[model samples]
Target chain A: MFLESKRGILFVKPMADVPSLTISPSSKESGEWVQPSPPRPLPISSLRTLTIRRWFWWVGVSLVLAVVTLLTCLGFGTESISFSRIWFILVGVMLGTESIHVGTDPTAVILLQVRLPRVLLAFFVGGSLAMVGVALQALLRNPLADPFIIGISSGAALGAAIALLFGVGISVWSVSALPVCAFAGALLALLIMYRISSLGHGFSIYTLLLAGVVLNAIFSAFIMFLTSVADPNRAFGMYAWLMGSLTGPDFFTLGVLALYLGVGLMVLATQAQSLNLLTLGEETARSLGVEVERVKKLVFIAAALLTGAVVSFSGIIGFVGLIVPHAVRLVVSADHRLLLPVAGFVGGMFLMLADTVARTALSPGEFPVGVVTALVGGPVFLYLLTNRSMRVGM
Target chain B: MVDSKNVFSGPAYALRDVTFGYATRAYDQSESVLKDLTCSIDSGKILGILGPNGSGKSTLLKLLARILRPERGTIELFGNPLSLLFQADVARRVALVPQETMQVFPFTIAEMVLMGRFPHHRGWGGWHWEDAEDWRIAHKAMEDLDVTHLGSRLVTDVSGGERQRAVIARALTQEPQVLLLDEPTAFLDLHHQLDIARILRRLNRERSLTVILVSHDLNLASQYCDQLMLLHHGHIVEVGSPQDILRPDLLETVYGCQVLVDRHPQSGLPRVSLPV
Candidate 1:
């Protein structure tokens, strides 16, 4: 390494033939240096191609994994259904030709109505949270930044609790009560953070992060207070929801979530190049033609919407957003064009698999997927922090 | 006669009675860093701004790039008031390379340079993929800055001089009519510094790139800059050719130090050396 660096230093001295001490600027011609060299395969350009190819490879693998996970999750409920039966039923349902009586084969109703929506919702929520995570990390320009760390998830949780405990909205089919309330809560927290952080120079990421920590604590306390005042049955429901369950939402809820995530992902993916420039630093991004304030607002709103939509249903599944992006970044480059979608796919598969474990771990009782994620995520985050390569990259 | 309406008729940048300061809060006004400073930089001239630490050299560059809004006066870019142009419009024509950058995330040097083409990509929304021509321009920039070998390396992993060169390469990819650099040579070794000086000189002569640089290296400023603008405590002490500005008394007054100014042995540009 030393020898290579020494040679690099020597190579940087303009002309290699001239001795180091006696080199003169007049020896070089101006126009000559501006000319592009004969197109040799530069390591940099080749590395770029390699990265793009590797990204495509990861995307293909993750897509296959997502499908496999979706199929595998269908078979792992309290009452075990064979994989072939699940596959047959799924294919028949999709074709809309074969009908199985729910009365005769109770497994059919359980698979179609109960397990299918839960599994799909888990995947969608996971993907949404991961998307939010990737966008927030880039927007804040910090590797450790995620929706939970920035209070978006907690704020959404508080909103969901208020709606669940106090009955804040009428039960509407088009826009569900919980998600709407949660979305409002998330946006409120976002507005407060923006206002407080923007007090000094634009948006100070440290101040925003500190504000998020404080808000998260405050919101969680409010949730606790609400849980205490509620009746026993409602309090039990609140505890389960707070633990992050995917059991309650129906197909309609899933559809609403998928629609919101789809739009949010598109908006975020469009700003991928801007996100790339932003990672360099706000000043550099501004100098490179990014309207820093505008991009920040767009990214913040999109990330908050994604987190609220998912948290409203899933009750704040932690670490999918924080962990999946870092894991994807390890394999793929940090180009948001690839990073956002890849993180989503990987996150979907991961949470689906986690949900499967949660369903089968205690047979009928079922652990919360949030508990599984934290149990899994905590070690991984600590490892990432301690790992030399990851720390340096960060 | 110079046509008055032509874009090249007047100075590339004109700052008239400009007073600027950073705001401490949304409503709180901080003290002014620069006060009533007026200067004009003509087209294709290499103007080196020399000043001590905290003398507002970087602030001046930021003001020219329109990063900071002035509290008092008007700054004109190519005869148009700065307020008349959009931020993107200013970025398309002017590129500023700051002294040091904090990059919390890692990126390849090529990727870093490619970002400089942000303003040139013609699209309103969605992923603005760089075309083949953009890549060609970026590669040419790397070659010009002599950093092609470091292109694949992470920007955070390279030596300070290599990083400096890579940043300059990125600035070149902007293809700006004017390039403003703040302490571009501060981290570079002597040879790399000279290389940068020659490269800037070439770009000015061949491409008609109006260049403005801030530096603490007086000898370098004297050697390469066509004109020197000496600033002391946010005020311009002198603005003239190197021979006229690189004088013992003027530099001593501004710098508060004793110095000897003589012609270079070979180049005939003024050489500033401290008496030992």
Candidate 2:
């Protein structure tokens, strides 16, 4: 209510009043006529109450787009299925009215067992990576910060490569060996980075970034060595996995990934306000009553968990994490409470579409989804870097 | 409104032989920043800490704000040990406005100001949004700083003076009993510098706010500060009223270059100027 009058006055005031308030001697001497433009209306509140409402509206729109993308992507494989049949199949399966039999209708089996799981996997993985991107960017206070750039993905890949080389997943009881190892690798990398950065009293962003770069190089070399010594067939499979193919994921695997992502995302959600403060600078955040040390540690761990889990499932898909958050920030404000969720949804939709294009663009033979993401995301990232206006609040 | 009556019933801050240093590579030694600093600031007074660069002015302010811990001695805030209080508790009572801020996100001026309400949020782990009362307080602070019109503008996009005012407004939104500022008018133009000093003085008189600002501008500090504490090489050279501290010999000894010290013709406050 207070903001309404303030907003009214701001609008009703003549445009000339704005420039007159900031008149300088140089401007008067230059004799250049100052342009009169209305001042931007202050948001309804400083506490982001109106921005929160706008975020919810975006969330609703994103949810609809997600559903549409899911259904549309499900229809576009080598065996193209009509939207009506796909919808019926999904609804029937949800309703338990139609039984899925491989012999009777192979399309239902393919749709339910193959396309659905992969599409959902893509969504979850993309969402997780994007959330990690937002968290890391805030944590480091650098716009270029992402899971892939910071070497977390390389650590996970190295772990997965080790698992594949050792045939750890072949054992009946250890089907989750690859993901578990990958998670451990990612945590190890994060721990090392933390230790190195904290050696100088507190976490130094420069040292952390340098350690990441060094660790990435080391881990990638180890992964290469492991791949070279392994059997040809297994090595080829590892190569495909390393290139980030979203294929052959079952519902059980999807459920496990979802569980990990859900927990990690909840932890991040709780820290949204603190992250907003942190972006202002650590000292400033502390003076504003944030426990900077504790916040940094928790966010680092949460980001690592999200990165490790997603990389374990979908190998090192690049740019979604970096690009999605920036795009979302452009649309929405940098308030993490809004940025995190909206970016998550947008990322999920983006990856789903990319995966669709990856699978169907060249019929019968599918390339890795990583290629698709990199192709699009790399150029966009460069554009963001070069375009001064597109720089993320820096 | 802040209670004008002395709620704590003592000096705002009492430091007992406080020493602080940054740890160096050698385990046996540290780079000492502040050495055996003992001082007490009276309640509801504006105290200025003046020194050359690296004379530990900012470090002293940081110690008072509890952003850094003293390696030796004790700091008491309103008769209670500062070390005993939690950071959030300290923040609710004491707010700090740094010399300058480097923001990595484009938060609006209003949003930046409202961040001062962080310490006052009521919820589990303080995970709640600011209520209507908080918003009202933030709006009032913005109006006081004359930044209400620029509330929607991004902090990074505003002029240096507007940004500084927004920072001060944020500190005000904290509803602090004691305010610590590092170079409150370092890069500000003369108009904004006077504007900021006047605002602090008004707040001090109206709310009985205790303000300790670290500054290098001797004239501004002499004009506005109720008391001046001069430091040289991590040690206090003198602590007295502006008339006593702004002496030519003492200022020259502390600053190594200052010369002229005279009364301002208008305010009659001691003013310091360099001789060419």
Candidate 3:
């Protein structure tokens, strides 16, 4: 019956005169869709489920990639430990199913004692810095924000240098003096910067950046003074560490770093929703019932602790914090719920890869991990500066 | 209605001898922005605040939203002194849609509107990302503002008018007793202007929402607003219904310009036109 009407045999109009239904209503109506009522907003439950699924997808992918990268790093290095031997030692020790003598194999000793600790330390430092980066970016409401940009890491390096130069870091209660001093220095710098930037009623981005630049200058000068006056033998080590190495940290220090990272990550993760609201702008966030001042205080201190702890051990590794979160954001939603955890995983993988290159790229001597991060990060930073879409939050 | 002593139970908002300014010395009397402003806005009515630039119209709206504190005198919201209420409590009852919003982070329109539910989800209630009820309210608000289609689009990627609609949707999600808007029509075209006005009118009638808007469009304000307040030089020059305040002489004196006033052809509401 509908076709007969369209054929216009029994209808008033002719069949050839029928307008094509295939043409969009837009092209039909004044050449416009005027009021093409959009579909009803997606159901909240569906959106929630969608994001949750996406979150898991990212976690799954990152987890797989991380496992592969870690396994690869474990096998390939200057010493070239056989994969099966390393695997046997790991499985046997973890499962306690097979006998493995550490004294019998030098490669096993190197793998279990030296290389494993270094790789684990690198992962923790990288992950903590990336988490700190995400938190600081949200706290400042500035996309360009990073621990290094704000000088938190520099303060830590200064503290570490003081401890090493003076030989004051005596092992106390299994906690080294260097990391403790470094954490203290990080907190101190954060406090000073916060005070200087908040001198006015509102937190000014300009003031914060300016204060960071000035503080970084002063601390670097102090570090230079210490290095210049130190004895020749110690000064060489100090300068190399200052260039941003991932060396000297033993398993005990790694355990302490893990404790700091775990606590900081928990604090930041619980406030993920608040951080999402905060990026909208302070006044808007407050109107939405966020205790703006309280959240700011919590995030600032947490980010500082994470950055400080990592910096104390790793010697002010730059760029991972700056590059990792921004890279993760390009692939995932900016919702902190997903951004934080994914960034942590990706950052760990990235630094482990970088460290592997640093150790193996040069056969006998290794380059500082910081140098590798900068060599990779400098281009990404330039791209962000040139990208028009990125200019919004800066 | 003009008599100060002829008071009903209470209006949605009551301002008594309210004074405010920004960064002025305590002793500098000339620096005050809104000086001795007194008025009452009734529930379920649209109040259009009209004034030239720098005439303290925006300042008055901000004071009402509690974005700024009054330097002197008291402002009451539903019979309670605004000063005595907690910030979140005030936010629950009142919402302000600023003239413009800047977002540095990229968020989908859906996520942006969900933020409106923030005030309602307080204490331990917000622990779960957002409840089903919150999403339902946000969805309904987007539907009301005719922005449900743009829900999945990035806010920065949409047009200015679409973004404005989304912002209005967010304010609706707040579900407040009083809605304060600064230049709601500034970025919209003719169709959207009327669409927004109709939405406000429907909300007023259906939900008994009290709307206070700051607008530069004289005719639009005259046609839709139940009452109008004309401000000049940190003071309210006139406050009355559209017919009483739409006079050419009063507009000229306040605007410092020449203008014509006439009845709209269809609605018979008084319309102000610039005789070019």
Candidate topping lDDT? 2
Q: lDDT tens string, model 1, B55-161?
A: 78888998888777788999998887877776677777888888886565556677788888888775643256676788888889998887776665666567878
Candidate 3 Cα errors over 4 Å, as ranges = A1-50, A82-84, A96-104, A162-215, B1-9, B16-19, B24-32, B36-38, B71-74, B80-86, B123-127
Residue lDDT tens for model 3, A1-394? 2321222222122224324346565578767644444453444443322255677898899889887777678777778877788788778668976433344567777777778778888888888888888988787776666788678888888888898889784567667787778877887887787666445434445556677778899999999999899998898988887777887667777788899888878888878878887887666666666767778777777787787678777787888887898877655667788888888988999999999999999877889998899899878766665767655533
- Tens-digit lDDT track of model 2 for A34-97: 6543444344443333254676787888889889989999999999999999998888987987
Q: Which regions of candidate 1 are displaced past 4 Å?
A: A1-45, A49-58, A99-104, A172-174, A191-212, A387-394, B1-7, B25-32, B124-126
| Model with the higher TM-score, candidate 2 or 3 | 2
When 1 and 2 are scored with TM-score, the better candidate is 2
In candidate 1, list every pair of residues with a backbone clash: none
Instruction: State the DockQ, from 0 to 1, for candidate 1.
Output: 0.33
Mind giving the per-residue lDDT tens digits that candidate 3 earns over B1-276?
022222435798999999997776444444439999888889779999999998998888878877778999899888878888766677777888888776766567788888787777665314346667877898899889887656665666678898889888888898888899999999999999999999999998898899999999988898889999999989999999999998999999999999998899999999888988
Best by DockQ: 2
Error of 3 at B263 (Å): 2.6
CAPRI verdict (incorrect, acceptable, medium, high) for model 3: acceptable
Cα-based lDDT at residue A207, candidate 3 = 58
Clashing pairs in 2: none
Q: CA shift at A369, candidate 3, in angstroms? A: 0.5
